[model samples]
Target: GSFAVSSFVSTIGKSAFSLPFEDGSGAALAADAGSLAGYVYLNAGGTLVRQPGPVVGAELSWNGLRLTVTASLPAEAGISGYTGKPTCVSLSGPVAAGGSEYDVTSVMDGAFRSCKTLASASLPGVEEIGKESFYGCSKLVSVSIPDAKSVGVKAFARCSHLSELDMGGHLRTVSAYAFFGCSALASFDGGGSLKTVGSYAFSGCSSLRDVSLGPALATIGAKAFASCPIESVDLSPVLKTVKDQAFAGLEFRDSGGSVLAHTAAALRGHAFSGSGGVLVAEQ
Candidate 1:
């Protein structure tokens, strides 16, 4: 069986790991670097790589300062497979490079996929969250993203426990399948800044009860809210276009509200198939 060796010796600027000598000629190293607890080691061909990761039972990861000068996170910002399941995760705040601090502006694709025990997250400075960022985080209950402008495809899919999401004021677009299978998501107010809700964006969110369509909304793509259990919807008067089956299988009734009237007039054919409902004014 093979074994690992580590040392406490620190490099000039970045963290480095002492590799197991293949030729077996150097002095042996010991496990003295106890402070770098969550660092993961990977054997790359013959070189050993070290990266920051989640702790044994930590409630958060990426909670400290890091260097950020590249287009994407350095393969270490995302974490998974912790022995002690974490209930909370916060991937936000600042990064440093050349002694200057920069706000973490984006979450990379598939950042926290399959983290089943994660229950909450708060991304403060993030402007864009990539595809499948929190996919399969089944226990996720809440999310708060203060600066997000766009949510990527399937970003929060399969989050069965996700009940609340505060998509702060600056959001512009909700991509396809963004909240697919999020059964517990019950509310969303895309604020006046929202423009587009892509295809299947909120499809299969069966527990969703209501939606407040923002004043600036223009497009609702195909099956945008299909299969939701919403009872009421305040469709924006400014809403112009709705694609195929955008609101299919919903439980909303034509409450005779002017908002519903305007929405009915704009809906494409068969938009509400299962509800035996159409946007008709109340008699």
Candidate 2:
């Protein structure tokens, strides 16, 4: 397939350089990138360490430069209400670390799953959005993740209300299911230092209208934009490859709900299966 978006449109998945690295498959990299066999400590010291929390996903904690990783949250951690699945209806706080002595990065795999009432979220200056970090945060209408370089699988899956995402121009990759099911995400401004966009990176994101691919982008993984209902998409000239099924299920209706011709042509095969809209390319 032609690498340029101007030449072709199709559907896809991605590589190891920056992997969501699920199932600890890339754990071997630890030996080469950094030591994983030792007890990482935190206290404003050496390189930061990310530990897996009781929640099954990774959590980030820092003491200036040093980071620590572990496998559980304290009994009083906000992720879990005192002793069980947080079932309270009250949303409180700038939920700080709570003076608790435990890894902060790891959250219960679904700590905030489908927390539709949440409207705003802020990542601690030191935090990185880990795998499935905010999956199903439907109520999160607006939020930010700065200093975020590497995001894991399903990091922002199903964040239906996210209208905008700012990559801060420093991000390196967009992993599988990174923004999958974020039906309300309209646009994302990536540093596009992004070398790779993985499988279903934006799968099921029906509301994304348009995005500017940065100059540094190189690869577009499978089904990266599957099932999105946008009217048009503008791609960067610097792109080198767009894998199979990378742009599936894409079509848009204007104020009057009419499908634009160019949008239909370019996304012919990539458009969603159930959608009757035709793919049309831009002039």
Candidate 3:
């Protein structure tokens, strides 16, 4: 049942009440009129709270989900949170606060940085991840961002336990140091849509061995895969350039274990520096 804003009694301090919306969504509103002078709505997926202020930002939460609003629009916002120490997070639709519904499309910079307790995250609708969003989250193991198109600089840097990443088919760019120092990461396949990998993107991932550079890959930045144990990678036919030391300390071999030949025109100075691998010109 819907309740008017005027129906709230001041005496109903620190109490909770349930209501049914016209859209058939069930919600519970909790408030502490004594001190917190604000409304917190508990929906199916999460909680949306309107903080007492000029309505600049809000705090969102649920059983295993917590988000802090960073940027607010009339009907949208970017979110990030680390205070609640949530172990698992799942985000799906718009969240309402201060009489407005916000569609969460991005995770703000340094959102969950250094949150050592976080284990996994599923953001099916998020389109972008800002710089250092999950940086230093040492316990994070898996992340699924099916709709994400771009990953910002050092987004997942130093997430030492991160092993699985589902970057979906729409991903195009992985910025510098995005996955740096993710030592547990095993393999990465840029599902036919990736175009650019920035400098040191996967550097220091000692466990990373298998990699599939998508068919659309165009550029590989300096030391992109340095210090990895990767044995081979089939460069895309349309690859335009490989910067200095892109594959340092790695060997390049074909399926038959023979040293694979690369196009000399595409490799910059010392592209294979510190590695036993060699590149030969096409006949």
Candidate 4:
């Protein structure tokens, strides 16, 4: 069986193919998407192509083109054999095998963890990212994952050099410690679609200064945005809940430009911890 992705094709639609891999042990192909995980392909032009080769002995290399993942990734999907030679990685569309297409939906735990040499990523069609998937990738700098829905715990933690994030619509939850310790992260553009932010999601992002949360945000969990240097954020009015220390160590301001205790009606216990600063509600 072979899979091929055509070149010049910019966007691969969701659920366009079906191809999943099991653990890193062997090239164990599956009969369906749920049985395996982590299938990737290199697009050639108008086709998605893959050569049926042994995972252990495969000469895995990304010459210049980006490695596009086309299935839900399993643990160690790109970790065991990858040397991080590619400058960019993305999750898009599906891969074809035996004339059938499988959808590339989510990233599994530790799928790309510790790929210190990897630099950039683009995940336009991904629905979720698993825990510690990109953790400790010191060289990772930018990302554009537009259609993400949920980000698992510690997914991008300790990516010290990461700077840019362009989140897109349809996003929902950000799990605990999703971006913890990303010291170089400067801004987050949660573009028009987000719901809940989990505990300690953005803790220790020292360089982050600006954030644009979408209108659909509802909950901010414990220490969700702690230890950042953000000066202000325009919060959505319909926000319902905020747990303890959600905004600890952040600087906030009101519309009147006066620094005061946040009076948002949805704030729960100790919503803003260190400096009594609260996000200014955006009208």
| Position 242, candidate 2: lDDT | 72
Q: What local lDDT score does residue 185 receive in model 3, on the 0 to 100 scale?
A: 95
TM-score of 1: 0.63
lDDT, candidate 4, equals 0.63
TM-scores, all models, native as reference: 0.63, 0.53, 0.68, 0.64
Cα-based lDDT at residue 232, candidate 4: 44
- Native-referenced Cα lDDT, model 1: 0.64
List CA RMSD, all candidates.
12.6, 14.6, 12.4, 10.4
Candidate 2's residue-wise lDDT over 163-212, tens digit each?
A: 85665666788889988888888776666576677899988877776655
Better of 1 and 4 by lDDT: 1
Mark the 10 consecutive residues where model 1 has the least summed lDDT: 67-76
C-alpha positional error of residue 11 in candidate 1 after TM-score superposition, expressed in Å: 38
Off by over 4 Å in 3: 1-74, 253-283
- Candidate 3 or 4, higher lDDT? 3
Ranking by lDDT: 3, 1, 4, 2
Residue-by-residue lDDT tens digits, candidate 1, 1-283: 2323222224322334344422222233233444322344456565444443322322233343222232212212323223356677565456433333444566667867787878888878788888988899998999998789999999998888899799888999999999998988888878779989999999999888667667677789899998887655555556778888887864333333333322445432222212233333222
On residues 1-283, what C-alpha lDDT tens digit does candidate 3 reach at each position?
1122221335553335333222223233344333222233234333333322213355675343455554332334566654566788777677665556666678888988898888999888788899999999999999999888899999999999999989888889999999999999998877778889999999999888767777788888999988888744556767887887787865544334456433324432221212233333222
lDDT against the true structure, per candidate, is 0.64, 0.51, 0.69, 0.63
Candidate 1's displacement at residue 146, Å, is 1.8
